[model samples]
Target: MTQWQTRRDDGRAGECAGGRGAASLSGGPSAATDAVLPRLILDHARDGIALLDIRGRVLWMNPALERMLGWPLDLMRGRNPAEFINLPENRPGPAELAKFRYLPGSSLFQQFRVTRHMRRDGTRFWNQQSHALIDTGRQDAQKMVVVTCRDITDQVRVQTALERMKDDLEHAAYHDDLTGLGNRKKLSQYLGSAPVRASIGTGRVGVLQLDLDKFKQINDTLGHAAGDAVLRHIARALGATAQQGDLVCRTGGDEFLLICCDVGSKAALMSRAKAILRASRAPLAWKDQTITPGISIGASLCRGTPPTPETCGGEALIAQADQALYAAKEEGRGRAFFYTPELGARYRAERQLARDLATAIEQGQFIVHLQPILHLRSGRVTGCEALLRWQHPTRGLLAPPEFLGAAAQAQLLPQIDYLAMNASLDALVSLRDQGFDDLCLSLNVSSAILADADYPALLNWAMQSRGLPPGCISIEILETSFMNRGAPDGCDAIARLRRLGARVALDDFGTGHAGLAHLSTVELDAIKLDRSMVGRLETDGRTRVIARAIIRLCRMLGMEVVAEGVETQAQIDILGRARCPLVQGYGVARPMPLAELPQWLLENKAFSLPVTLPPRDEPSPAAPPAGRARRRGDNSI
Candidate 1:
């Protein structure tokens, strides 16, 4: 029979080269036939193969074994196989496999798990040592074992993948997908089913709801991509700001709910809040855009009750946090506020105040405060704008912030509008009969009135009945009213009023982002710069520079300029330098009723001012020739 010895091509590992064994076997088999079988098996083997003697000497090997182990088969003769062949620790090596009990007369297959095995150059492969014992009755009638190996590296990789999927599935079940924080379901499970603590404990649960301010504006104006970027940035910041016991989650879009378990001290919670605020203010570097995101946070502490601190309702905590968030926004953005009993009281008070407003309006608790509008060119009291003030009996006199929202809710806007409109029109008609020529009255009109089909007819009837000049009455409109230009019959109402001889002036201009854009679209006779812009104009000389630029722009567009909310003489001085055509605010006169109109006229003796025209004043171009301008400026009774 023939035996084989195997070694690597590099002369270090085993290569099985088939060789004839001269020994004769006792099994009734021919010696030549047995030798042919060993040679045939070694040459046809797929893996590198080898044969070893009892003394661990490599006698024969195949060509595949030499290439597989990087060793030459010839060089491996008479060497200890254990010294050169590597074995894995967890499995049997060649020496261990040789100890397998076997009958020398019979052929048997034995597999030795490779504890560790190495290449000729010392690299490793997972190997399985497969062998069989056979008896050859030659050379003292000895028995031999033949061995082969196959690599299993790719199988190990597949096994690792299956393990990872199992781990990921387990994680996804209890954590939020967006932020990897504990989800609401997990929170409910923990608070509901978790074990208890001692009767006396420091277990407080602080839940905070954080909302991103101006996030919707980014979504609407810059596309949802920007909005998503902002959300992800917020998630990262809040996650890092949280404590070991705190969990932060994205409750929904642009809203993060943080849960701090066992937070007992107010000082500790405040410290945590300061950390969150600092992190939220960090700049978000996304897609080359650095966005400084602002967060409004509302925090509420759950009351503790006995063993395990009886858990508070999650919905109640969320609601309290939401109210706190709203208050934070009202106070200004980028802040964390705790929900307190005082805040709860304020909430109840404001809610009740909002409800009582409609009744107040219907009861005629709303009065008109007439602020005098002065002619800039001649410095004469040309008109007055009827500003609405609400006199709530219990709440005292409330301004626009008080009743404006309620008027909209009760659908009493038209009623409120008519009240102010008629009162000013009646007073003007009375003043005209008292020989005040060319006197004008300006009343604020909502887009609601323009939407009314009878608005043009309504104003015409009132003007004709009073024998008043149609051109002497003007309506003030906000610049933002045209934002919804897509409305049906867009601006048709404003156009009809123009056709009815009522002039229109744009009010609160320069306060909106699209203020300049609205100017060319609407046919405005004058632009009233808003208080913020006027107040801004004082601090920022650049603001007046912009104001001058706007004045230049209005002049190019053939529109007049009116400066609103001019309280101080300095504001008037600035307006004078800008050559504003009109000014209205306390710097001129306070709003009074019809009975006081003649008294104001007598005190100013406005009629004589244009005759002694100040060096800086220019008589209005609207003033007729010389005599009319003189009489209108004549302030004496």
Candidate 2:
């Protein structure tokens, strides 16, 4: 029984399997019977069908093939199916497919060949094809091929779209939107993985942490957009400096992290740090102005022996780098430092101090001390400079230098300043009640406080609440505060304070950038010579000339001059000869509590006549019952 069949485009055959269908094609009496069934099914099938001769020429095709491909069967006749099929770039080409020519038809359906097929109208659709071969059992038998195809264009489009969305999501998850660098998430993921942890104990991971110095000044002076531009510029420069396999990330605002793998030695790590420092120091042009930014860098090497994933944590590395970064800033910025245990200890101490500062302010653990400022001619006390002292429950009394920096870093300066000012006012009211009405209270005001527009109102409220006149309180401002003229509320705050009958004194005058220029623009009532200038008056002849010139200039400007840090008798003699009127330092009296001031004033005749200097460490008086007692021989003030 020979099975007759037709050829297909893929060199396969579709056979009429039943004897009844075979007899119908031969036009027997039962031609319209079951013999016509195979022909009917092929013509009306949902899938496209095609036939080809053994030489790979299309011989016949079903109506479904024409509908699926949008091509007329007559025009597709004798055309090679490969010409209309669009295979992916990675798919086997004709040359590779030729190797499978001798493969048996039975194995063709093991995997359906999916590819795109073009229509006569120049459009295309995806097709899944299955192949089979047929043979005519005759002396000169001709081989035929049958190819069945299904349109899968919709499925392919959906799959491709899904893959593109997946890629987009992955890119967004790992990359920073601003800098196009790996974000914290990516860094954490990398560090937690086996690759980063494997190098922990081997000292193969070097992390350099960089923080921009004075960036806050730029942000405050310029706008946020300009700040962002600066950050992008820095990121580009830092990224350019990265070696192959090194990753740079903007881990925080004005802070960056660089992770280097397989670092050879500590010197090599430092060399990289130096390069980054140099890059950071290079001036950048923003809005037609050249701005040179300084950077402090801290580097850490992972050298955990026999490291586990948890043993060398990313946070631990970052903390070590932070400690070194703090050291760099402490030594003065624009430098780099390697992580050291000493630095870590110092950072821990500073952190603990900052943490305690908030609590200290909350608990009102601070106190006010007054140091007498004397008139140069009569040697009489005219006013007192209010100084802040921390009376720790266990540490007794601590000077401002011990905790002031930590307070400033923790943003507790405003509260502490308020505390000091209110305390000074309270002491002023106490002294006024005791007939010390002429004495003025000079209190230092931070530039940060002046930057708030609400500060003037707050100050007025404090003074009014105490029933003290505004003229009795003199605000001492640091010289450096005038360096930036663009501070939003500083200049206005000062003007408002002066308008409210408060006298403004330019404190630490000789040490800052503000010279005659700043003095000309800023309205000041008094000029306090910085200690650096005063200390040199008795020692350095040139310093004496500069001091005399400054005093003369202030006198001409109608601004009173106060010499600070006047210690030795020679210094006082020099200042008096120079015609500097007011002096404030240890030569008159050390900073003492308000309760001790009256007795000290009586014993020394500080405000009326000439006062002699007491020996260092001499006990002045006992503390009041309400106030904490002072330790004898404790001359911190």
Candidate 3:
């Protein structure tokens, strides 16, 4: 009934304090001043203001309040506040209200909340509302509640958008974008969290580290897009194969980590590894190719008695898995292996050896030893194979088998290979200076070095600088070198060397699967029979027949046959009977340091054979010139 509670047709409140009920709102002796000041402040204020009874029935509203709700004062008066604003049903009780009472000698108490309010058009906006109890001073009337509202829709929207952006950034940081799998950071966080540690204390946790076997070959043979597709397919397969509680993560290129929290025993962990290995074998259809992926898995289990940091730490567990992975790859890829104490010990030793290798290269500790290759019929030293050795300060002289694996893993193969090549070429230069120009120095090279575009140039430079002829240098490559799909064709690399006038030989011929096939496709000067076949020559009659057949085959193919690891005269007789031209083994002579080679050749110059063989119809391939050979009484050095 108050004039201030009424609204005009323009949707605004009427004049303030124009009715008896409105005047009564000013309770003291300065009622007139109070009424005028309050009206001026409420009418000019930007925020919406409303007055309600104790029952939350709207009694009055300001012009701003009328505009904010889109409802006129006349329509809003005497109606519940909920009809216009979406207030929560549960209001503060008397005890809760007591905590909000602040000012002394006043009935004013405040409560603040954020809620949604609706307009006449049924649109909703975010509203920040403040409610306060006010003393009315009329004995018959209950205390009034003063409410103020602010439209915060824009602020709320900004805050909501910011929250969503933060969530998206967090998701991106923890996930691999290529596969949408958790990354190493996420895995680290999970493994290092307190809950995970506590769980490990109560039970066992298994970690599986997976590496794609020959993944580089895939990238080399196919394009990078194919490699990416394979990775995504593997990720999907892992996600589907993983148990509910397990976490699958892409640690880095072609490497994945899986954390299983429910591993009860070693058997359970092994079973999970087996399942992953099987899952990885499923072929992926990529473009026009059906790519069969292979993975090697290494598993480790961590069990803590009381959850010590050392026992359940992420690094230690991952290291164990990595060592097992190395072992799995060593044994041959596409399989799974569990971590053992021995593996850890070997891993530690290898790591230490890797560190020592860096020091060895720096200190000039690596040296070359020459093993003489003899002509079986003449019993004459013809050429020598350059073998790498490490003169460790504490471990004496270490052979290639003792440290080459560690060196390869440490990525020091290039440096070691270069060292061997330079040393061998220098020795060849020294031999030619001493009138042994026909003696060939065979230097072993890895596939990685052979595939390098710059390798031939490096070799040419080294030989030119040493004043050595390329014909006196023989580059020996392993059969496995030809099997690397990631590198250029072995025949191409060999041809490149041969174009430089250097002969190439396939070392360890009978040990590999494709040696016979390679002899046909690969243009080569010679083939070396593996030591395994040479070791079985006297005992295994089949080995002798195979050796004889290989020698005759190589002779017909315009190739030379060098029997390796020959240790006895009986073996030499068999090879001579087979017309094998070359023999090199411990029985002929042990590998001696470069400095000792001259004296050893001098002493062995008089060495004669016990048996003689029929002369060959054709000259042997890759044999040195007749002028390069020394007579029985000739002083070569």
Candidate 4:
């Protein structure tokens, strides 16, 4: 055996003496050994290689280490690795690792950790290191640790970019774009997660639903930008007023939802509701205008009661809160309501009705019924008001009040309005073909249609396509639509209809916020007295007085005054005495289908010679009939 000493390429002797290591080099147990080959391999290795004493002081470094760290081997040698290596904050440094107890003579290999190393220029690079202890096999030899490092900066950058992308996606998924609040996705996620339910397992949690009353008015009148500003302010107010651990979300247009965990009692929840109300009610300065949006809130609670099918999860709670919210709106806005079993039952019933309504529209179950409007003086059916009736597959005829709210809420009112308009137009053409050519059909238009600028053009096109004159169709809108200050476009729609030779009437007058002042500004062919005024005329002297005033004002404005809901002879007599020009109700004739109108006219002897109207002071394109009629009973149906 020939013992050989290990030496560097620089002719410096190394600590290790090779016996079989020298023999293994030549593939035989002989003295032919090449110690320079091992040093050359380490010096030229692609990976940065460093040899360190047990105390972690660098003994030698490869050329690759010098290039990777921007430090030459001469500058790196004899320096502690900790001086140049940077670990993340709170991680142990090389000195700490060296002090860590290890089994004596243990030779762990391929130990890996990613660390940041500072270059001589103070720039940092990420390095993935594999460290191991190499035994020198000499009696006075100190153990040398070999650390092999590869630059992993590009890999780390890719992983960091991926992480940032994931975070951005999470933020977009959870936040509402307009309000910057948590969105429906966040709400659903939080409710399904364990953290929210962990605090109150089958116990008390509260959900409060908030809606901005008449929020559409802001959007319609001031522009959507103002509405968006209002919504953002409302969201901020809700967030600020909410206590810790409360989840607030903007669930829909003009709607918000809050989930409160560990709610102690109804009173505690009420306090939160009040805070939100106050915050929202605080005047918001927008576009140089003070906008105080009214907020309606409804709350539902899941108490310690065991979870049932009805109270299973957050969705059920949300449904209950929605019911309460409807009640709050009904009870007048700017208040809060708590969920009750009765409200829940009613909500379910209404939901079912809404579902049925969608089907009814699709299946053409909705039929148009025309109630004859009689000229008060001549006792003649001049025109008919088109009333909506749902001819259910099982429930028989249903009135508008039964399903209109549901339709409005489900955003199906526009469809219903379209159907009704078509039915009315068809009926009008049918009536004209049946020797009722001169008759005018009064059809109710919804706010949704009036909001659309294109609706006027569509209506004109429909009438033109039918070869029917626009004068044959009269558009009627609720007084609330007229009273809407935000939607001047609705009035514009009315003007557009008038320009197309269609008569416009304000329906259900005296029920909404419009007053005599509104009559001065709102242009119309007629103003129909609301049923409330008509129904109470004989009983309530105040109603009689109001009706008389309304009729007088309308007449002076050259607008026809139609009295609605005149069910009794006395109501009719009183309206006649009040000089109301037109009246429509069960008293005149119940709302009959389009097919029954001619028969009803024949049976009730409702047709006199066609009455001619006097010229109005306002010079309307389609004025109401006030002219004297010639004696021609030959025009009978």
Candidate 5:
């Protein structure tokens, strides 16, 4: 048997020697030869165990401790654990450790610590260590500490991996996948955080909302892959443009929000918005095409000595910026605007009007009104133009100018156009039944409706269902409608309508920059001089010369000319002198409801005017009576 003994600091032997020490510690048999059992058990234990004296110097170690640290017990004897173990800095010092002494009747003084320990080869690993203080019975003997250490390196590795994965998940939840920018969730969280609120309370903060204009067209035309590329590119641009501590977030598709901290004034906020606008204007090259993207920005500033959350909340700031964005779009796109209370009121009103427009459409509150188109030579009613009027139940009759802007914003113009076309066809059917079978109808269609691929088929179906000839329907498109990217589609639609035996006219001509170019590119049967030109025809000589030249050009091209807004008799005389075939305005007849058309037609059927001949440079043609001259299907007025 290997007997163990304890030596005091004074080099005196204590009572805890031989089997007596084991008996005193474990309450076992007190025989020197019997000490072998406890020693054998300790040597075979899996965990590393060590014994330290009262001053924390290591006195003895089991074989497991030697194997765990790659050091023999003899070499570590009388050494402090601090020599091999890297204890945590927060661990108790000597003074604190002295307080953890063994008390009477206590189960045993013990403590557990997880810390890193260095092996003999200088590699480090985690160890879950437990310390217990032993109480010796003899007064002359010193107390001892027993420590057991379990290797926990694998468990620590697993815990570290789990923590890393948790951090990654949190990042993904708060960021946009496509752009890698902060997302709406992150924006909301940041704005609501205590730090940001404190900053807003003491300093100025600005919220800028950016919306991509014409993004839908690019997405629809070039595919979503291109759109995603554009979004990533814009994200980088915004990140570069933002100052330190500012946050750029991709709020949604084609829209981003920037939160600026410590903004000096509203002017500084607007300047930042302008910078963003300029950044977005740069063209992006995708595949074989260059896409020039445009953005509109709206900004809202919040500042006070101590602003309340109710006044400077994230939601309120975003709402204000949105209202400013609406104003920016209203004035013109690709610009910036700051929020104001008056602008918010206007936006709210328009929003309500848009909602009411949707309800109006559902309730069938819209009606068709027609103004007679009179032949200049005969002064007789030939055909009438269709005008849309809203019979608001509470607001009374509303003109197109009142609600058309809101309807456009609501994307309801196409629906309104379809309704007007159908009603006008029905009105034409009624006129045919009332002995005006030759009466034609002209309907004004917006660019969106004109560019729609399904419009021609819908029109054909409406005309067929009403038992009206396609020749009785004329489609009038604004000159500005053909000056956009959709012009090709509009031209294709016009061709389809013409093939269906319907005549097409360029309405409000001489108002657009590309009027003459449209005349050459698009095939049309008539051109309606806009009210601006006709209103100036009598007083402006330059207008007179331009009017003469346009009429002569159309006559030579075998296209009819209609003078619109001819309110004065002198204007009619001038148009007659210019050989304008048709004239329509209040001077001829104000727009009346479909129910009043038949009576008006009856009263104007016998009206006649003096026929005017063409000038010496042009070939003169005899004027036929208005009713018989230009019937449905006749291109010539």
Candidate 6:
């Protein structure tokens, strides 16, 4: 394309510098062919070729030239090319090309375009016409000018088609298939595009990540087919309410996202969000079933040079929104809340607790509390379960529920195991020194640590190095953790732990879909029924039935069952009579402080075990029953 463009001294468009005369340009060679040789020279060129005489007349033009210009030779000849074909005679450029003036006395060529060139029939096509002057290799030869015209209409049409397709493909790449809205991938890409304050003066762009509350439960109860329908309907509702040019995406299951742009104010943005919520709350009908979906929305401003989605990044906007959403659920459902500076400060405090918890074991901030698990039949203190607690000095006895929450949020399950291991070891040493032999102390274990390949070595080193009997130290892994049915090496971790002489307690049984299967391979020494199961047992027969089944299942496996959260004496009498051997509960004692537990042991030293069994020998009426009617006169069984 780097042609030798000849420019006039005055900066006008000119033809190529190395222009050849007709004889040299083509040599079909006949003396008779010589006079019309320039015509022949122009005839076969691919680009439209036209020759215009100095009088502004089209003296001759080629077949390709006529086709390009949409003109015939009969109509074109003897008329000025300009009269037939129109152009912007006064284009802004160098004086000579603008005026169509030739350079003085030289073999000059010019390439100038006609803005609107017309055909012989008055139809127009765009042309990029080039003009050149030639010498006949004779002294008095008239300067013959050659004009070449090329049509660019089809090229323009194809280019237009390609541009449209490019836009469409780009849209397809980033949009959700069903919603015709931005997908997560496109949202991420758009987040990457540097957000700048438009001089057009729209307010800042903010993102709201709204996940439907209890969505999974709904999906499970109703069916994912209905779940998918609800999701689509909600998406449609929210999409209809979204601002023009605003983006909406279904990030994942039942989580729809909004990228709000050009709002007038925060209040206006809030209104938009409220609209979405209202739209979602409207009942959706699918396959003759009507259901209402509730949305929990977290909105945050993208406040930087290139604002990324706070919703998508770690501890970023999503966490803020999520915490706020959860807080809304805590206060009540069917509500919306904004994350404020106070919430952030509270989150910072919680996160600090989570982070400090990393070194909790290393710094000896965590300690174990041993609450005695009494045998229902034996009427003796059989064992104690090691409940992990953070004895945060300044904070003062932070319960497992407090820091454990943040630990789960931070996804620090391994940290819990690490701390719990040391805490368990220390408790074993303490229990041994206290002459509490033949007593089993259980420590809670997370599924994450159990899934670790090196968990056995870690547990062994902690237990064996401390001269702790693996039999005396039971590790309580949650029942739900072992329920990954098709997991690679499923339950293999627990099997390894059992081989290491550590008894695994299936903590929180009856909490998941897989109940029996969890106990099958878990090799549990015990099962602790969750408090939810226990709390409703007196009222809900179904709960009592499940507890009875769980107790029977544990007994069948030769495993002891510990019913947790035993608050009422009735609960105790229920389990005691059912002969569910061992139980730990608030009715017996709340998780006492490690310091207070030893004292609790001493205070309850003359422990008339609150257990039931048929006497080995018949008790004479004369001899007082061990638990006196006054031990009953205190009237708290």
Best candidate, TM-score-wise? 3
* lDDT (tens digit, per residue) of candidate 3 on 171-223: 99999999999998899788878767765776677889999988887898898
Model 2 agreement with the true structure over 167-276: per-residue lDDT tens digits: 88997898777888888888888777776666665658888998988888888878777778778877887897898867788888888899887685679899999998
Report the Cα lDDT for candidate 3.
0.80
- Per-candidate Cα lDDT values, in order, are 0.68, 0.75, 0.80, 0.77, 0.80, 0.66
How much does candidate 2 score in TM-score? 0.82
* Candidate 2 lDDT score relative to the true structure: 0.75
Of candidate 1, the 10-residue stretch with the lowest lDDT total is 628-637
lDDT of 3 at 423: 80
Candidate 3 residue runs with Cα over 4 Å from true position: 1-37, 87-111, 139-141, 241-246, 303-307, 485-487, 612-637
- Count the clashes in each prediction: 53, 11, 0, 4, 0, 7
Using TM-score as the yardstick, the better of models 2 and 4 is 2
lDDT of 1 by residue, 287-306 (tens): 76777888888887765454
Candidates 4 and 5 compared by TM-score, better number: 5
- Residue 154 of candidate 4: its Cα lDDT? 97
If the candidates were sorted by their TM-score against the true structure, best first, what order would they fall in? 3, 5, 2, 4, 6, 1
Taking the tens digit of each residue's C-alpha lDDT, what string does model 4 give over 466-554? 88877667788887865553446666777898898788888888885776756777677777788888999988998888887887776
RMSD of 4: 7.0
What residue runs in model 1 are displaced by over 4 Å at the alpha carbon?
1-203, 240-253, 277-292, 301-320, 339-344, 358-365, 376-380, 401-524, 527-559, 563-581, 593-620, 624-637
**Could you tell me the lDDT of residue 40 within candidate 2?**
62
* TM accuracy, model 5: 0.82
- Candidate 2 vs 6: which has more lDDT: 2
